[model samples]
Target chain A: MDEFASIHHWTGARQSAEWQQRRGVVLGIGDDTAIVDVGLAEEGVAAPKRMLLAVDTMVETVHFNDATMREEDIGYKALAANVSDIAAMGGVPLHALVSVSVPRAWGPERMRRLYDGLYACAERYGVAVIGGDTTSSPEHLVIAVTVTGTVEAALALRRSSAMPGDAVFVTGAVGMAAAGLHALLAQRVDGAAEAAHPIIVQAHRRPAPSVRAGRLLAAHGLGCHALNDVSDGLASEAWEIAEASGVRVVLHETELPRSGSMAAYASETGMDPLEWMLYGGEDYALLGTIDKTSVIAALELFRKEGIPFFLIGEIEAGDAAVELVRARAAGVSHSGKQEKRVQLAKRGYNHFKR
Target chain B: MDEFASIHHWTGARQSAEWQQRRGVVLGIGDDTAIVDVGLAEEGVAAPKRMLLAVDTMVETVHFNDATMREEDIGYKALAANVSDIAAMGGVPLHALVSVSVPRAWGPERMRRLYDGLYACAERYGVAVIGGDTTSSPEHLVIAVTVTGTVEAALALRRSSAMPGDAVFVTGAVGMAAAGLHALLAQRVDGAAEAAHPIIVQAHRRPAPSVRAGRLLAAHGLGCHALNDVSDGLASEAWEIAEASGVRVVLHETELPRSGSMAAYASETGMDPLEWMLYGGEDYALLGTIDKTSVIAALELFRKEGIPFFLIGEIEAGDAAVELVRARAAGVSHSGKQEKRVQLAKRGYNHFKR
Candidate 1:
């Protein structure tokens, strides 16, 4: 699939979690400033509220590779990467502080363009640049963006919320960026490729976040069990969810959604496209789980909102490992449907690996 | 003096700006999250507040000299640098995301130590590590930390508040860090210097922040006219206040408090002791201006809180500049009782040149 199309599918995986009113959190993550009601001052009545804070840094080449990515896309992807955490907790994005470490060769013009792209992404997601620190670096350009967000008291979403049997669903498709990367690297193009295929390159560079989806999910009282962004590939993310929630995940191969381009690229690369779908990184999509009974309604809501989604898998009982089921009615290895089994890697991405 | 001392003295130049409340900010820099009040629902308000954001970074040799600095210091510095910005704005700090670019030679132990330091700093500051992206670089280890801080309203301290005739003051001593560096780099007295001057070195390496000072300054109704932290030398900071507030600064040289070791180091280096006093950076003390009438009351309040401060200068109406007056002597370099004109270039530490 093209990059935007890939993004469409990738975005389908995210879901927001339920919120609770906790102490010291006047606001959680859905606004410009997170109001934290501090219980520090008074014994019976009034206590002065205090706050604590932080941000994120995602760089191109250093943090991500743009072997075939677009500048605008890079900008969006960088911002979205940070915002995903805010969305996970239903925080409203506030102001942003940015610092860019750019190579001297890129100079001011390229820097301006990069900022324009960043601004575009921030605007699309409804955020502002309040303050930042900028300096020169030796090599490739780096962008560090910090976002402030707020939520109502105790309404913050955390990774430690998933429970066993919570149905797992993804907002969009998987492995689109990885697929795009493979296609770009292979240099194979045909009449079959759409004009918007290059946009996919942009998608790989600039992934817009689903801030609206996150807000809606948090507000609707949907039974989302947990939340996480898919920056480190689906399988890796699955493991994180499982570990955090202390539940096992059984991902059916039949339910996996892979774009045609990703499939073709995987075929050419002598690797399972499913593996790329499962373990290729940098999609920036959100993955969430909800009760089985609430899935249809949530899906319907997303459809009405023009947000794509899929009920890809279910949360399982027992076992901490992420189990992949490969059921077969034919000789082909389809993405997620499975009644049979196939050999799979026991691990996902590891920093120590060469 | 060691690395810590230099960092401490360097930071002394900055002061917290008077807090002013603007619309749409729910929580800000001192908390776990910067909350922004926004209208998400269509029927909620006129304009929904946007996202909260912040950015901070670590340079190769400047912030951390890998040769002598430990991995933990590097990590702590990276995180602390960002957290300071949040504190400056009186916002609550929240989840922090980090990005690092390191030379291949840096190992897993180093990286783990860096994370350990970051976590320790976070724990001390009450922040959580949400997400980040990492990659390799051919040169220096670069770390960018973005912290999201929330504010109750869109209120922040700015550089534009010093009124003419304000009493300029500083919290904590100045020039010690620079003095420590001069001593350490010059290889002064062996054991005596090592034991006696260790505090200066510590001040340079692991400079503790004035977060409490900043918050106190913001909350107190002391009529603070302008504020900034001393990072660049005190003279440079004074210039910032003068320029931002449309005034000139007249400092009493004798009143510029230099720590004991800092003073000794300067004498040993054969460097003009006064030069180091005015120019050495990384003090981290706050240089703030208060209304003339508020001076005594402010000091009284500080006395109650047991916070130390010194009345160092006075804001005057003129071109933005810093004038130095030597005590009990008559040697004219400029006008009036000013014995010497503290030129911007000649005063304070210049990162690029030094």
Candidate 2:
């Protein structure tokens, strides 16, 4: 079974029982993060601070190998993945518990470097590594991080809140990390590629989560509706929003954000940049829908804050689906220069199916 | 380095940083659970609710093998371990996030059985399986569970609260799980062992956490102090309490609780039951110290509530150490029936060294 199917099976069982009667659980199972009502508020204040729970795990060969990730990068990316999940819900990360299963052969220095990466990321994000479990693994190394953060109850973002005519936007560029991964896999980082595309490799190694942009979006609660982190590529994330919100998402291919380094890497490698943008994962950019009327204001605010914000798509009234509009090459179609609308399939990283 | 040493290394770094300045964190590392003040209160109430965070991980081959643990049992014990951690802090478990890295060869049915075990334990403890991350492992299956619980801010238990002149106590029998594990390892469950000592095998398979007893102790806040769950054997946990509270812990060897089945199994195998009681881990029983004046009252309360309470030891005014007093054989000592004091070393399951 696929990840979603397995999750649905478990969630279905939970819903069928008295488990659903739990108190203070605002959102569970199907979101980027689970929202729990911590219920603490300033006296006379209306909104309670809700706790956002997010967990992400990285396996050695699956997520990173020796060639792709160093010890510190593995630790940094594992924690950053969870932080991005919290950011998707517009939460400020507070505490994290990091559980690691290290191989027996790893010495003190390697383990220390791994923790150094974890501490570095934790310090950068203002998160305290509160408590965790450490065990010895016989084979591959596995790191699972769980983060708890707080968000205003009402302003917390949800993927199901997207409405028709909402303007979907993404923070920063997408596909840079994917291109970086390709570069690493091809071992093209020797001299020329490494000098020209250092940002791509850095992007792959340590992609920053858009916490500030998420906070800004959350602060503009009236303008932002649905938010998600692009971990499973743009197409897959768009499908998630479409499925969760029950709205059609239409993306303009030419408007999809791409970095110069990513474009250059793709061109030099004879790879399609659009393929990386659509199918490659681990971009760690925030994707969300903004109210159409407030889209201009939101863009202006993001610009003022110096956060990269790109309007990439629009939500339309239709059945749950994601479509991409690509400009046909000149005279390629019978109708000259027509926009060819293609259905985007839910195809990205599936841990089971892969 | 040993587990404690590694943990100290990390915790020392956290202590020296500005990260410790985080507000609302009542406790950090070096505890069974981290306590964060949620700050929500009933109108005009003095104490706020504190959230307890605990995480535990069980790695395949290290913690279990096919001969010892079934798929369902693996899932159950993994979650139960985290639940026990929460209970050690006198907290009520409310939610859990499970992260599992299953071997790729495992079928869907195996995965389903694993979830069944997780759901059963969660349902039994009133914990919602809110969120998790599932990935494929190339070799060993690793399950990490993180649980969030709630306790009254004033009554949350910690290991650093034991004082001189306190009476030490433990709930239920110790070392039953060790005997059970031995029975499983010996493959003695075919006919006589399975029929005569079924409880032993079950003990190892499904060790229950003392949640109710923990809640009772928390309720009797004036009497209880320095609570811990026996995850890494009695001797190791005693050392933890002694080190954390800066008091010497003294226990009588004859006073350590043992089940009849454990004794029988030990006799059958020509093994010392005391050895298992001292160093065999995974008992998951509540161990703590109570005020000397309130020990009688506490015992009476436990008796009235039908909970097994054993007065096994006492806290003494001394440096951090753990000692065991054993009566010398009648003819062996120079003086007849003299008590022999032996220092108990911190020699339980050390993940790193072992």
Candidate 3:
């Protein structure tokens, strides 16, 4: 089975609400930060205090490269990975807890560099590193970053809240990470000097997060119904939003945004550029749905804020399928699967199947 | 040069409040959770709401078995690892977010089983699974569990709170996990048939968090000035508490509790039983300090509450050291190294290390 099929089968039997009675779990798995409801300080309040929390991990070889990357970049990327989740829910990130599995051979300077990187990222994002655990491992370094944020009950965007007819949108460009990875690996493939110094490398190393855009969307009453970050590329994540929200997304082929880095890498590799644009991972951008009526104004607002994002598709009332609306150059009807999905198959990234 | 030495060198130099402020961090690296004061909630609270958060990662081969472990056990142990951290701090755990990295070959059934295990553990601990990311990898399964807990301002315990003369104590038996792992590995080596048994496997599989002990300790006035879990064995953690609290400790060997299982495993493996007891990890027990006068009463109350615990040592004014008082054997003396660590040469539960 494909990645989505397998995920569906696995998550299908999951009963998220069955465990809700456990103390402090205000919100369960289907949302951004599992909301932990607490009444520690408030006395006789009719409602419980809702808080959000999440944890994410990065491995040395899997999520990043320890040898080539700056310690600061690793630290920043680790924290950014979690912050993006908070942003997806239209929440304000508050603090972070970090735990690391350091290789025994790594000396003090490496740790300091890692910390320096963490410090820089935390400061840039306004989140504090409150607590952490450190231990030695024989091999790869592992970093687990947990962050907490808060959102008003009325405005919190969730993955399960999308309504039919909502429009699909994504923040920034996608596929830059995929392109950047290709560029980085190509440099190593032939022992070629780092000749193609591209911006895609930066995108893969540190794609900016959309915390500000999410908050702005929430505050402006832009009718965003559901939200999630595009860490796992656009096509795969679009399918996720559709499945979670029970909507079908029909994406326009011409509407997708490809960063210059993505295009250049595709050209250099002789691969379909749009596939990378749609299916790349670690972009750390937001993929959200808003009422179709609110799209134009939302676009204008993002433009005014200098945030590069675009409306790419619509949530339709049908089986969850992503369709490409390309006029056939020759007069021949085509299957949506063949014309759209197969064309973008290279971009799809799944954790279990990638 | 060693793990502790590296940690000390990395942390000793860059202690700065300015770094915290510049990062928009209200709290930075040394606290229970770095506090980044966020904007006021629209609910209009009289005071800013405080949230406690933490993240920890569990690797498949490094932290658990890739070949023989059950999915539920994997999930439970992964979440429990982080929950144990919250419990050590005298906090009430609220919610958790878990990020998982698994190989594509693991299959949907394995994924579901893992989720089932996580759900079971979360339900028991009163924590909800919030949001997280999942991706495919070619390596062993990696789980990063982030948990959030809450406490009133006056109640939260921190590592830096220990004083010169605090009494040191631990909840429940130590070295059970080290013993457990040793038993499992030995059974594998000897080709013991019972290695497939559920209970024996589960002992190495799922670890219960000490939430009750933490809550009781925090609620009562029985002071535990410094707190951390017995994750890296008693001797190693004792040194950490001593160093963090700025004191030394002396352990009476007779006071250290040893289970029959631990003794049998040691005897079978031809390993020093005491070494396993002293240097084992993943006990999931709380090791902490309080006033010397309150030790007996605290232990009694714990017994009444059906929480198992023992007082094994005392904190003193001197360079931090652990002096073993001979019970049935010769006493062993340990002191903080120049690196400020009462070093344990071995790290617990790393599979690939020779």
Better structure of 1 and 2 per lDDT = 2
Best prediction by lDDT: 2
Error of 2 at A115 (Å): 1.2
Cα shift from native, residue A55, model 1 (Å)? 4.2
- Candidate 3 lDDT tens digits, B1-354: 654565556554453566545433454555434444333333456332344666667666666664445677788888888788778877777666667766766777888889888878877887765566565555567777777666655667777677777777788777666666655665544334235333334555677778899888876578778877876677777777666766777776778878776666667668786776677767878888888777777878899999987877777788666665556533333543221223333343333342
Which runs in model 1 stand beyond 4 Å of their true positions? A1-55, A64-72, A152-157, A185-196, A264-271, A327-338, A342-346, A349-354, B1-55, B79-104, B112-139, B146-157, B186-196, B303-306, B326-343, B346-353
Q: Which candidate is the best by DockQ?
A: 2
B50-94: candidate 2 lDDT, tens digit per residue: 889989999888898877778888888989999999889988988
Candidate 1 residue B323 C-alpha distance from true site, Å: 3.4
Clashes of each: 156, 0, 8
DockQ of each: 0.22, 0.56, 0.34
Q: Give per-residue CA lDDT, model 1, range B186-239, as digits (tens).
A: 544444444667877666655565566665666646677676767667887787
- Local error of candidate 2 at residue B294 (angstroms): 0.6
- Higher-TM-score candidate of 1 and 2: 2
Candidate 2, residue B326: how far the Cα is off, in Å: 0.9
lDDT of 2 at B148: 94
Question: Quick one: ranking by TM-score, best first?
Answer: 2, 3, 1
Worst 10 residues of 1 chain B by lDDT: B11-20
